[model samples]
Target: MKACNERRVCVTGATGYIGSWLVRSLLQQGYHVHATARDPGKAQRMLSTIEGIDRLQIFRADLNEDRSFDEALKGCVGLFHVAALMEFGTSVQENDHVRRNILEPAVWGTRNLLQSCMRSGTVKRVVFTSSISTITAKDEKGDWKPVVDESSVTPASLVWKTKNPGWVYVLSKLVTEEEAFKFAKENGIDLVSIIPPTVAGSFLTPTVPSSLQVLLSPVTGDPKLYPVLVSVHSRLGSIALVHIEDICRAHIFLFETSRAAGRYLCSAGSCTLPQIMDIVSLELPNWISKSSKVEFNRSAPSIISSKRLLDLGYRFKYDAKDVIKESIQSSIGNGFLNSQVEFKV
Candidate 1:
């Protein structure tokens, strides 16, 4: 009915935000994890944080290299491919990095892992960590009331496009997931993809920003969006949101369930920008700029319904305001939001 608790699973990006949490969850479930990262030094940190877990193992595996995961995937029964360069601001986030970092690994790495899994014969299935961005959001803006789920009305934009990084990261996931689906079809590998929108909830570590920043800021105090996103901060809270752990749990649900193949939208509820601020301000008054007024974007997605996952009996821990408040508080408690943490946006 489910994978053996002793199943050896190989998790990529094990030192990253989502990756790190995924590693912990797998270990908790009695899964023996062979976790990987680009740097061996980072592996040491994972070791420290993940110490005392009897079933845990760590190694180095770069998404950019050719034979990077050869050793990592050798004998594992499952693979969690989570490494990706978010052009959120890094030079390598987009451009060649999309192909080298995301596309190659998400696409070709699946190919390589599939080959290894086929060779190893113990490999079961691959549960890919994807984003709601892959669902093709028409580049419009509006509030999706009673929101949550994958729908055609979703709004789409790439980070590399408007920001310094642009949409390369978004495009990379789209291309990679598409390729993964095609490859899985060809190889008959059980490949499942989990897509979440505007992810909230604190990272297990401080390496990345919550997806809410990219989604929320656009409609609130975003100078880049000046008139469009910022002007609508008053109404920004109505958009769809979900907690990161819920997103991760969705992947685990699919990993253990045979019928979980194909795509599933993962989300909790929706709120407006001001509403979101109202939630965060309660706990993170010092971190948030009280001076800025919240606005709503009529141009944003009307609603993102995660009813697909919910109908399947999956429950969410935090709704919009609760998730935002908990996430900000956790970050503050974790020292990521100290006065010393320098972040312009």
Candidate 2:
């Protein structure tokens, strides 16, 4: 609500892939940052290399804990809520586990954080990181819509019928985002949600991100992730994607842009499995052997759009090829994949 030149902001889930990068980006932009993480030690380890590390403060906070974020939110003019339970390909088969472990933490955690924000009195805008699962792009008859954008939302009833851990995770995001917007509006808080498809590119976290795990399944040839990929395609008609850097940049842009309201779809584009492999092959010629084969149709329809964010003058820094290439390079750098070995799906 008020403008300040101090540029003080707080980022939750600071130890995560996006959160760490955002912290670094903010620090590079000369902001005084308060970063919250479940384990401050891990947060320190991940963020120690940041350029303006001295301007950053790490705080231990949990979404499930009421008032935990109050201390962190104090004096901050903005908040980036990036923490959420993500179970992309899980076999946790229990309704209670789904509700308790995933759903409640996401929805109620948002409430807890927002309550802290309102109490802070200084936080003017809140930027929320949302998933593409919130956009189903389906009609009443369960058919694919011609084009999907900010208005498209996946129904809770549809998620409930699937009985899938992945869909349950989607439900968490869908419900949490709705709850966030509702609370923000009722209390007169400026809130913006950035919905990203399968996020790829390098990460700052110690482990590979769950989204990257699913995105890189083709190269890893991990059989367990096949179902997850199938489910994503079944839900959104194709593997919709966004670069990690672009998504993080979008988060900051939405927070800074005064007119950015409601939800913004932040996808670079969508592509089929064959198209993904072809991009990989072209980017890293030696990574995919001639024997590697994928039979899926190459053409993938673009079902989602980012026209709102584009109209706001935000541009994506990476495209499909750049995203996949950087992801592969990061995978190799992290020792998750062997550069010398040829990969096949």
Over 1-345, each residue of candidate 2 has an lDDT whose tens digit, in order, gives: 434434999999898888888898889888999999999999998899879988999999999898999999888999999987766666776778878877777788899999999888899899999888888767889877888898888888878778554777788898899999999999999998998888989998888887887777777666666567767776677788888888888888888899988889998888887777788777666665432344555665546788888999999888877777788889889888673347554
Query: Which candidate number would show the highest TM-score if scored against the true structure?
Result: 2
Q: How do the residues 116-196 of candidate 1 rate in per-residue lDDT, one tens digit apiece?
A: 655655667888877654544233444235443444422324344453223455566777777777877888788887776
Evaluated against the true structure, the overall lDDT of model 2 is: 0.83
Per-residue lDDT, model 1, residue 251, is: 72
Could you tell me which residue pairs clash in candidate 2? Answer: none
- The parts of candidate 1 lying over 4 Å away from their true place are 1-6, 90-106, 136-166, 206-239, 285-294, 297-301, 340-345
Question: Whole-model lDDT, candidate 1?
Answer: 0.62
